[model samples]
Target: MGSGISKARRGLLYISYNGKVQKFMFDRKATSRDIQEQLAISCGLTRLSNVILKCRGDVIAISPSMPNNTPQEPYTLEQAGYNVSANDIIASTVKEIGKQFRQAFMVEETKREVYNRVASIESRVEKDGKRLMEMEKYKLDLVELRDAIYNKQTNTLDYNRLRPAITLPNHFYCPSTEQESLISMARDIPAYNKYVLTNETKEALKTPQFDVWQWEPNEMLILLEEMYFELGLVDELDIHPATLKRFLLRVQENYRNNPFHNFRHCFCVTQMMYVLIHGCRLQEVLSKRDICVLLTACICHDLDHPGFNNTYQINSRSELAVRYNDMSPLENHHCAVSFKILSSPECNIFANLTPEEFKEVRGDMIILILATDMARHAEILDAFKQKLDNFDYSSEDHLNTLKMILIKACDISNECRPIQVSEGWVECLMEEYFHQSDQEKKECLPVAPFMDRDRVTKPTAQIGFIKYVLLPLFEALNKLYPEVEFIALESLKQALNHYERMKDFDENKKKLFAGPVMSKSGRDWYSEKQMVDEGGQ
Candidate 1:
């Protein structure tokens, strides 16, 4: 063996096996198999012959030790590249072993806690997935119910049970073929084609014609297009031209072919609204809210008019009068019917507006349109007249009253047109009144004033209307907008002068009177316009 060193000196080797530690006893004389035999007895896992033992990563050799005392030979475990001593068991004590065991126990405890936390998270995710599936099913049920309520593909609405919220059933706008054709005509108007729009369009609006019977539908559409583009409404409102056309056409079709309160009359009122806003520079005085209200009210004010006055509806006990409790029946009907059209997505020109924006438009539009009832004419005129000197533009009520006057002025703007236009509209109005008279006669109801064809002639009727209705309204409007006042005064004076001359020509006295041709339609066309044929002779 070795010279001075004892080969039988023992040392404790702490072996790390799997996730555990064990202490093995070894001597300088022990071979690798000797360590394996210890491992087999302790762990029952080292019975294999191929097992090798290592201390601190270097292999322990089984061969004979180095012959005694070479000066370079390893003399201790430290010199042999292992930090071990004969007293290693005492230094690396049971206390150190207990600390390592506790550390291992804590690691296993941490792993179990982490696994349980992951399982809880997975359970929550599963519950959320089920809830999401339930919500999806509910949404599908709503869609199915909507589809069953209205068939958007068929372009048919269940009008009997229509709710405002589901106006067009999923916002689908489908125009009927006929409505589409009419809508096409609406887009053909001269949109900003200044050169294309005849001087008649500009002049008729400026010196406006009195007789509107000759004003055809094509001219009206062009004027509307001119107004829309001029106001930049197409861009500002994000309007689809075809959709606007559908709305306009729909409104037109709804207007009965009555002689005065007809589609042509609506066109006239709309045009006058355009003139008032643009010509009077009201476009500057009002906000976009005011402008939209005034313009839209003018277009829809006369919707579903029954060619009869409110009093007549009340007296005749008409359904409309009953529905509205006989107060402003026609005006209320107009507002209701117009909203019904607007409720349709195909005709809702204001669909692009937000709910709040639309609500504002709706409130103002109702106010402006309801002001057109002639029964409220005195109330409307007097209210504005009282507010003229102390008018506060910032005050909502004051501004609303002003807007009422504006829409009313547009309503009777026919009286402010040139002699022919004023005379023509009078004829249309008289014809409507006479038709109402006829209905009253058939129903055995008492005829209203100025509506009796037998009693109230055109000259007397128009003169009375101009003096009592147009004069008071326009005179008040003049104080607010002088530019508008000049034309209204001039046209009204001219029409009154003519009607004043013809006041003597009763039904029997007109046989001798001769007048100029009013239209190519012959005697009947000028029959109402032709006055004082016999002159002052």
Candidate 2:
């Protein structure tokens, strides 16, 4: 019964042995001394102990201390515990079996752990990459949606292509991808571009019978741009540009009074505010967020104004004045309407603003709009002059002073613009005042100066107004804004010239001058210091 066996090469220990005639298995873990004494004669060479064990079955027999050397007999073993025939002796003399098995097992376990960890990391990276791609796709989709809405092509939206819903960890859920995309897209589009482009076309189509010609889209757009730009100036003012577009859309849809206080008026005011912020250097004093609020106030300052001045409300005990106890009734109404629009989720351009920012916006807007009331004009002018008198042009506080001046300037900005523009506004105002006068007389009520439709020499009164009222106001504004003085002077000079050119003309001119003088005692009322005292009170 000869059998083969493998041995531990490094340890020089016998792994197994074979036996036919007889053979002895050497311990693989045996020390050098043991191998030299016990196994050297049988093993042949000291270093060849492992080879001798592997070739155990080939030899015939082992003779102790034979001359020179002798071939070893194959060694075989019988099982000590299980009674099973053994081909070779196990290499257990040095406990080698236990050590080798433990080493192999640990190596396999380590390799497996490393492989699993690598797989997990790769999986996580793949998942995150996919999430990022999805988010980017959503953003692009929103931009497309905004374009479609501006073009009024919402019907063309491919709703089916949008995701059902996307929820953020913050609990904000965009119900449909299409909706989210549209709103987001609107954010980047300039709200007033179309208005600016179309203003001339609208104005060109106007006729006296249908005074809609004065409604210039471009002018309106300019106004909106100014307001939006100002709002963008405040710190942490998180107003979305989309909110402003929505607000403008609402104004266009609901308020269409033909001339002054219409959409065009809002537009102009908005642009005027912008000019104040940048050209007038108010940006240094007001925060970007305050600018937005100011712009909003400008846009909505005369909203739903009904084309009548404060005198109409006071004289009629109008519902608006009565409701607000005649305390800046029109101003209060305009501010309330603006805020009401802002309260809508769709109109909350400043939705991301802090609570404090929102409060400041509301406060600034109210103050500015209320200041626009003509009754407050004198007071505003007086305060402005006083501030200028004590001007500290070099102080850091110059910005604040500039803001106050700009607001007041914007409130009466029409008086300081081109003569033609100012005259156009005055004409519109006079017409509305006369219309109201007609209504008053029809209702059997007494009417005030410009409000009374039936009167003599209305045109001459208007010319006198240019001399006493308009010219004085312009002179004051010129004193404050030397750069704008040319416009104010030109406007007053033109009005005066026009009056003089026609003051002595014939029959047709007399017909044109038939109505009562549109002038009143308070035409220069805005320039008095008394007005400022009343305003402060």
Candidate 3:
């Protein structure tokens, strides 16, 4: 190491690429080239040709071939106009990278999906072309026969003729082999269990880990199928694993490429919901139907969120708010869009269930999904609090109240996870908040508090949120389910303490940045103190 070169900051370096976040850290003596090589590896890029490093809209890439393993001259953090702190976001502008990559990939994937779907539909048309006419004839003949028989013999119409009143005897609307091949992918379940489930480095079930960066949307179907298998819900619920995979693929496809509210967030929330369910043994309290709905709702709770809050929707007079009459518009949209996906022939994972069962599941799913509305937070919180006021474990309403509370907790449980995970989600949320703020500014609407990135907030705001919002919610939960919330509450307390310290540091930093400090000789109080002090050396 040269005298001029210094050690780089050793902390978590989160690499966001193609809608996937990979966690890594640079070596202390890492040069610019080292960073490039590490970044390439961390982002799962095969070659460095396409990789571009940007900071605040400025390109940082200097050469076509980035440094391999060769050690090079060290670059100063100061030279790069950055600070090497204990907890630093080295790639501060990585959100833009994620956004750009997601847009590009989404476009390409959308084209592929559209092409496949069109081809499948065409193939179906070609195959069902004959049956289509037959179905039409059958429908026409039945209508005509029924009309003539009823007209001729009024009440004495022969029931024998109408015995086989089948409208399209075959399910022609069902998915063809081509469509099924597109929708479903056979998974190596044993590999998933061995690699993801059994691995020590992977996050343990119900045991929160520092890694909260969502698994890539590309890997969602496999992970979801494995999740379904791990919970034994496939056999219990009588859902074929292939149907579940199809359902998941459709759901994931529909999720918009928003920074925070994408399919990755859905997986994250579903992961949290899994922890809550098994950790609290809510399954023992609630029926399998309720449990299934709870988990499923977590998956579909934020489908197609447009990266705007309810207030923005109402103020902008968005169609969603208008359609829902300003009553949990996003929640309603999520439920409706999700159920519509489920209703598709290829994606109907719940098709095996009876009509009553399906209805109950959908109804419960809607209730649970709608419960994620922040406006209903206070209402749900108060209602649950009232339940806590008069505790009853056996009551069905009480159980549902608890379910609502758990789902709400899981929805925002990003903070309840390990600190690294917590920080990752906070960054994600802040990015989303800043985007909303930018939109609000463009629309001439009042920017929401703590949303605008220009007006920086101290850790005080986070501390307040954890204390005021999450603390009470988790506390109430902990009272009912003792050990279930201990880990989460402790993490919250730790975060609170951290923010409190950061608040003091921010105050001091503000003082330094505010103005020039007054010298002792410049102050009249100095002379007064000297005169008051006896035997001052």
Candidate 4:
């Protein structure tokens, strides 16, 4: 073959055989059949009929225009997109099988196997493409639904006026007699060792002014139990007091020792929710079941907080972010931990609920807990605001939105407390912020401006948070429930003013201390020091 083909006609081809690749020379005008005949002869085959040719793992027939059994003109190297002059090696494989019956059968079976694998891969790709299309369609459907309800272009909500008013379900009502007995039963149930609920403590627990720092851990646990009992949740939900206590203990234990997002903070939020539920007269507006959901959601909202915010979790690419796909990672972990504790039969406070009831409560609790994520703060607040003017206690949509706002209100109600209490919480929050900022520095991640210790002061931090974020929320709540003005809104305003004064004092103090310094020469100390300094010499 080398003597027959001229140097210009010689072309390089790489053939893979028996798990090894070898180079071979062929004529540029040689067809695949001629190359196969040469390879068969080199392999000691008596006839070319015994050799099967494959290119790039696919079987290549001897003839291009017809079957191998038929006689027709075959494609040359150039016709197959191979440039021999450019030394482009055409990758081919030679699967040698004798003309024996078993060898031919095996070759045919191998071809079927390759075809089957290709078909399988194609099927999977098709299925995955279909699923992606379906997901895209579902996302578009939600967008369409949102536009139908509220058209952003016109700033109009067409569905707002279309919703018919609804009435509270009969089961949602709490009987006065039953509630009184339930309170008595809850109070009478001994919760902790040597801890008694005195009149002062009971009264304090009823108000948002209840100081979590004042009570011992055991005392706080008892108080948490009392709130659930006092709200008639234990009796109405048929939760055994021991079961409720176990659940409370589990919740308290799950909360890590973070600076601000700790068990004490959890207690504070739950107590605030309790105060809101009573002070706002929400029980008359909502059902007993709804109250239960509110209190429970507050208790489990910050469970297992790691002292780090969601931003850090996402930016760090933590295990939590991977597990929850980077959407509200910490919040999602909180929900997971909450349900995990509830999964234990001994700590299952809602065990008495039917499957349907449990499912609804579980869903509501997740929604409320997830709502506490600050990323969704604006969305939740705006939704509540839109529903506020025509707020209906009977409408489920309106009621759930209110429940969301209620939990959110309680969650951040620390500033709405007495100045002393709110100030203490501010310190705790700043500590947590600084801790996270330090970690961000160590990890070389972007630090939040408000969290940067070098950039923030107590007064500067509280001013914007209260003015922009806290005030509008509380003021809006005050419109629907006038009691909020007395309970929390006033306190928030006072807190804002107190911080502003402190800010002013800080500025003046800076100016006072920043005055021209006097020296022994009665000149500016900085100027005198510079004169005497070595650099001045």
User: What are the Cα lDDT values of the candidates?
Assistant: 0.69, 0.54, 0.69, 0.76
Steric overlap count per candidate: 10, 32, 0, 0
**If both were scored by lDDT, which would come out higher, candidate 2 or candidate 4?**
4
Better of 1 and 3 by TM-score: 3
- The C-alpha stretches of model 1 lying farther than 4 A from their native spots are 1-215, 504-537
**Model 3: per-residue lDDT, tens digit, 421-530?**
77766777777788788888998998878888888464856887898889999998888888655657888888888888988998897665443334444545544455
Over 1-537, each residue of candidate 4 has an lDDT whose tens digit, in order, gives 346877766655455555555555566577776766675555445432346656545566643232222112222211222233422232221222233667879999999999999999998998789789979989998786677678676787766532211111111102232321211111223444667688888888878787777887667888988888788888899998888877887777666666688889999999999898889888898889989988988999987677788898889887677778999887787787788778878788889999999999999999999999988888988999998889887798988888888898999989988987779889889988997899899999999999999999999999999998899888888889999989998888889899999999999887654553433445456555655773654
RMSD of each: 29.9, 29.1, 30.6, 30.4
Lowest summed lDDT over 10 consecutive residues: which window, candidate 4?
Answer: 164-173
- Candidate 1 local lDDT, residue 224: 65
Ranking by lDDT: 4, 1, 3, 2
Measured by TM-score, how close is model 3 to the native structure? 0.61
Better of 1 and 2 by TM-score: 1
What's the lDDT for residue 160 in model 2?
A: 46
Give the per-residue Cα lDDT of candidate 1 at 379.
87
TM-score of each: 0.57, 0.51, 0.61, 0.62
Report the candidate with higher lDDT, 1 versus 4: 4
How far off is residue 155 in model 1, in Å?
A: 43
Best of the candidates, lDDT: 4
